[model samples]
Structures are given as C-alpha cells and as structure tokens.
Target: MDIRFLVTFMEVAQTRHFGKAAENLYLTQSAVSARIKQLEEYFNAALFVRNRNSLQLTAAGEKLLPFASSLADTLEQARATMNEESIQYLSIASTSNAWDMYLKHKLDEVKGHLDHVSIRAEICSHEQLSRMVHEHSIDLALTTLPFKSDDVEILELSDSMLSLYCSVGIIEEALEHFNISIDWGQKTNEALEKIYPEIKKASMRTGSLQVALNYLSTHNSAIILPAQIAKELVNAGKLHEVDSLSPLTVKCYLIYLKQSKDARLKKFIEVFKGMIENQQGR
Candidate 1:
C-alpha cells in the first residue's frame, strides 16, 4: 500500500475536514477525496461519516488512527536511518523561547565534546516538536510542554519560574501601557489569565524571550520572564521584578526517541544530564 494514502488518512483524521486537510497537505480537495476513497476501498470499510456541516471518523477510521501514526513514524525512521551515512548532522528542534533561554548554550557545550558532529537547531512551535521527534526529523527536543509518546523518552529538566518584570522607575506606567506577554505554556497562560482577568490586551505579545528582552532593554516595558533571566538583568540594573505579583512556574522537559542510539544524541543527552544536575544543585 502507498504510504501517502495512510498519510492522507491521518491528516484527514486529525483535521476532520477534507478541505482543511487538503490545504495543509498542499493537495487539491478532489485529490484528497480520491486518496480517502482509495484507502477505504483497500481496507474494505468506510473510514469517515460525511455530514453536511462536520466530518467524523467511523469505527474503522478510529481503529486505524493509531496504526497509521505508528506506520508513518516507522517508515520515516527507516528512511532517516538508511540516509544516515549521507546526512551527518544531528537536528534539534525547540521552541524559540527554549532555544534562546537555555538550549543554545547547552548545545554549544555539547559541540565541544564531539569531534566533528554538526548540530542544527530549528525553532518551531510546541505543537510541532512532538511530531518532528516521532518522524525522526529531529534528534532531540527541548520544550516547556510535557509531551508524552510511547515511542519517546522524556526527562524532566527543571522548573522555571516566571515573574513580572520592568525597568527601574516606571513600574506603574509600564504596567498600564507597556505590558507584554510571553507564551510560556498552557498552564501558565491559564494562571496568568486568572490573576489578571481585566488585562485583556498587551502592548506586545510574543513567543520569543529574546524579542521580549530586546524590547525591554530600550523601552519602559513590563513583561513576564523566567526568574533566572530576570534576576540576571536585575543584577545588572537593567530590569526589576514586580514585587506584588506572584511568580508562575513551568516545567521543562527534554525529549528524544526511546530507540535513538546515535552517538551525537547520546553525547548531547550526557551534556543535558550534567546541566540539569548543576541546575538542581543550585
């Protein structure tokens, strides 16, 4: 069976709308419909219940979902392993915030331990990181979100606390006009919303901590930042923490395939373990 059909089926199952799945896969709606029909015929079962306003998976589709995901992942992993001799780089995927705040430095340290391994870091959203890891597109992932997969191993790195921070003299003015928000994770977002329900709009909203730092350096802005970073800036007299608001905590995790045994990946995991140990010691 063509793997593309399984891919199309999984996409439609995820999006639940053939049109939306077609858009995401860059295929025409007719093509997507044809692929679904092909897969249904091959399996001798109707995969989807077509409703006028919504689409839903039939019992067969539901049963096939997990198998499809596993097969796609297995095929991708086999391809990557087969091409390993030709491609000599370890790919690391991270959220922009994690890349900026921590992983970049740790990866640099990991590079020093390796002789000739090249490391490529890609910044992506939290949602995409798990899929990339499952597909073997990335060797490792650093994220604040707790990602669970039977095919992957997850290590708890540390808990980072986020606190409200601003420049020296305009805490009040910054609070009113220059409040910024960062996407820490779902839990932190919900906690922040509960704490400041009236503050609907921010002067700026972003996922990059580096961007928020740059904006804060030149402007009288206030934002929530990792306590470690905010403390470093405060020690340098560049930013100050708002003493009134409590801090929100987020847990960080390092993720990789359970079956990964690449030399570069093992070396990086050692470095990450040491880094986590050092952080815990402090």
Candidate 2:
C-alpha cells in the first residue's frame, strides 16, 4: 500500500491521460502506467476503461478517487504539521471565476486581519474545490456549488447578480459576433435561456470570468457578467448594461470542515462574513 501509488492514481483520474499525468508528476509515461497497474493489481480491479483516443474511470476507480485524495491530503497535512514553519499556513480553494468576481478583493481585506498566517489560495474547478475540502487539502473554500458532506459546514454567502453588458458603440451584428457566454451554473443557464431565447449561439463560450472580461475589453463584445463588475465598467464608460434585459442572480457559498480546529481558519471565516455583511449593508 504505497502512498505514492494512490497519488499516481489520483493524478491519472484527474487527467485521464497517462502522459499528461506523468508529465505533471515528473515521471516517465511508462512509470505512470506501471504505478496504475500495480494499484489495479492491489485492488483486484481495473480502474480505467481504455479505448482509442479516450479514457474513463471504471466504477472501482471512481470509488477509490475520494479515498485516495483523502489519504494524500492527510500525508501532506502531516508533513506540514511536522514542519514548524508551516504551522501558520492556511490554504483556500475556489474557482477562478469566483475569485475574479469577489473572493480576490475580499481575500486582500481578510489578509490584513490575519497578521501571522501565510495564505495559499488556488484556482480550480468546482469539483476539484470540493475534493480538496473533503481531503483537508484546503482549510476553506468559496464556491457557487455546495457540497453534500456531513464532515463539511456550508454557509450561504450572498447572491451575485449577472447582467448583460456591452461596449457603448457596438451594433447588434458586432454584439452577436463578439458575444461571450459564461458558465455561471445550471440555474443561471436556465435563467439566461429564458431571458435571451433567441441567442442560440455566441462567438465564445468560457468558464472563466477573467477570460470573459478580457474579451470584452479587447473586442466590442457583449457578455453576462457580475453586476458589481458591470457597474464598475459602466461607470468607467467602458461598458454599458443591456437595459432591455433583466439580471440573473446566483448564490455563493462558503464551505469548511466542521471538525477543523484551526483558530486562523475560523478567524478568516469570520472576517469574510463580516466583509460580506458590510458590503450588503452599503
């Protein structure tokens, strides 16, 4: 039961590509294959369904993923605990879109409240964020997707509104040509469809809010973005809201382990909540 094998397994599961996983782990592709084979032999199950130009996790692999992630997280935490300098380290995980929309600025404000703690924030997918929290790899997570885990405590943060926006001089043709679609979530998608039923296609579709912003800045593009951001850009005369349409709202949630004993983690959560409250009050 080598921990390295579990690490390898998790990497392969994430990438679903032996060469990609090996490159990330700095191992040869053959070495990655060997580790996966050994892990499969140990479990007496095939972890992956390999096909031409495709790879997917088998049922056993799906079952092992969470446990392997948890085990790897535990090992990492133990190592960090053994290192005296890492005692004050605090890790937070969130999607890049979430970070751009609110968490980035809020984190800056919170950092002032945490005098001695070292912060490590990562941008990852919602699924990855949940896995990290469950595995204890991250102390806290700010996400739109809530996790259904007894070991985790979820707090409703706030509703983020998304409104359609475009540059002032863009015509309908240009707007359609440079339209950017952002994946807020399933609920937002449904709302968007109801609001803009005729917009069957867009020039670009992305999950990254930052990318959407960049495209809007460089092109005469129209996009649905966080209301706060849209307002700021509008004030700057860079963007204007599509007043003909209504805004869509999405709820954001903060998650942390219920069993966490770290004082810094608790304090950061308090600071974050207070900041949100103060913002809403204004």
Candidate 3:
C-alpha cells in the first residue's frame, strides 16, 4: 500500500468529506476518491459508509485510525528531524496582530542571540499557527489568544497596552489614559463591547495597525495602537493621544509542542521576554 493512500485516507477520515479533503490536500476530488478506493481495496474492507448525506467510518476505519495517525506523525517527525539536522533551523510564527505587538520588535534581538541557527519568522492565521506547532512545522507560535490543544503547551507571555490616538488632541486636559480592551481575542472583544457600546456603530474598523495609522495620517478618525508607539508618534508631533476612550490591554500568548525542548527556541523566548521587560522599564 502506498503511503499516499494512507495519507489520503487519513485526510478523508478527518474531514469526512471528499471535496474538503481534496481542497486541503490540493488534489482533485476524483483523485482523492480514487486513492480512498484503492486504499479500501488494498485493505479488503470498506473504510467508509454514507448515511443521510453524512460520511462516517466503518469499524475497520475506526481500527485503522490509530495506526494511520501514528505512522503519519512518525514520518513527519522524521522529515522534520532530517531538515533540522541539515540546516540547524528554527521557525516562529504569529497572527499579524500578535506579530506586531510582541515578536516583531524583538525578532532581530532573537536572531542575534541565536546567531548559530537559521531563523524563519512568519505571519500566519491562528489556525495555521496551531496546526504548524502541532505538526512540528513551526518551532514556536505567538498569538493574541491561547490554543486549547493537548499536543501543545500554552504559555502566557505579557500584557501589552493599546491606546487610542488621532491627529490632534482634544481640548479636555482633564482626560487621562485609562484601561480598556480592543478586539485582540474573544475576551477582549467582549470587554470592548461591554464598555463602549458605541464602538459597534463606528463606520470603520480594522485588524491591521499599519492600515489604521496610514488612514489616521491624513484622516480625522481615531486608531488604537500600542501605547509605546502612540507615544513616540505623539512626541514626533505626528499624532495625539485620544484619552477619552481608555487604552486596551492585550495579553500575549505562546504555543509550542509539549515534547519540544529546542535550545534555540528556549534562548529566543528568554531574550524576547527580557527585551519586553527592558522596554517596559524604559
């Protein structure tokens, strides 16, 4: 039996839909179906059954699940180990907001501290981060929210303050910066909605900070930004703090495989945390 057949069977089993499995595997649906048919023939057992438009595994498939999963994981681990031994490489990734809020600033510092290892930094979706970390495709992942996975350990990194800013200060000197929440995670979004009900009515909202800043550079709307960055822009006379709405507290999180103890990843985490502390002290 071909390993590709097992791989296709696993994908189909996981998704329970040939079309979805094909899309994820980047193969034609007919190809995926053919592979599954070949796999069933090789096993001399029907692996799946269709009922009420829903796909389900037969007893044979249920028994094969553990073996298939173990084989695929072992093969992937072997490939990753070979690549790591050949290149001495480490990969880190994050959602765009988390990348900007945490890892982006300290990446160069991490590179310097881990100069002997090659680093690949990436911006990816939360799902991609979770999947890559679990599959050993990425060494570390930073996120605005933690992933609930038995395969990975979740680590709380730091809480970053995001403030509201505009092009000009309001006439209210009595206003002071206060703590609020923006849409970094489920909790934050709920908090934001609870506190500032009007935020829901705002005509413009965005996930990318760069887009907000570019819009604020010429427009009159407010943008939520990291407090440190907002301060620097304010000092440069490019933006002003909008102190009425209060700042947002976004907690950073990290995810990595539970079995991983890579020294390069360990060193990068330590250096990055120290940098955050130093920046806070300043």
Q: Which is the leading candidate under lDDT?
A: 2
Task: Encode model 3's per-residue lDDT on 1-282: one tens digit a residue.
Answer: 656668888999999999898777655576688788888888999999978799999999999989988888888898798776765677889888787767777678777766667888899988888766754567789997788866567777767676566556532431222222235566666766676565566555666556656655655555556675577678997777665334567667878766556775676667666766776798
TM-scores, all candidates, are 0.62, 0.66, 0.61
Which one wins by lDDT: 2 or 3?
2
TM-score of 2: 0.66
Per-residue CA lDDT of model 1 for 49-130, tens digit only, reads 9999989999999999999999999999987985775545677888877776667656767677665667788889888997
Ranking by TM-score: 2, 1, 3
What CA RMSD would you report for each candidate?
A: 9.7, 10.5, 9.0
- The lDDT for every candidate, in the order shown, is 0.77, 0.78, 0.71
Q: Worst lDDT window (10 residues) for model 2?
A: 170-179
Q: Pull out the clashing pairs in model 3.
A: none
State the local distance difference test value for candidate 2.
0.78
lDDT, candidate 1, residue 247?
50
In model 2, state the lDDT of residue 252. 70
Instruction: Provide the clash count, candidate 1.
Output: 0
Ordered from best to worst lDDT, the candidate numbers read 2, 1, 3
Q: Which whole-number lDDT from 0 to 100 does residue 266 have in model 1?
A: 85
Candidate 2 clash pair list: none
Residue 34 of model 3, lDDT score: 77
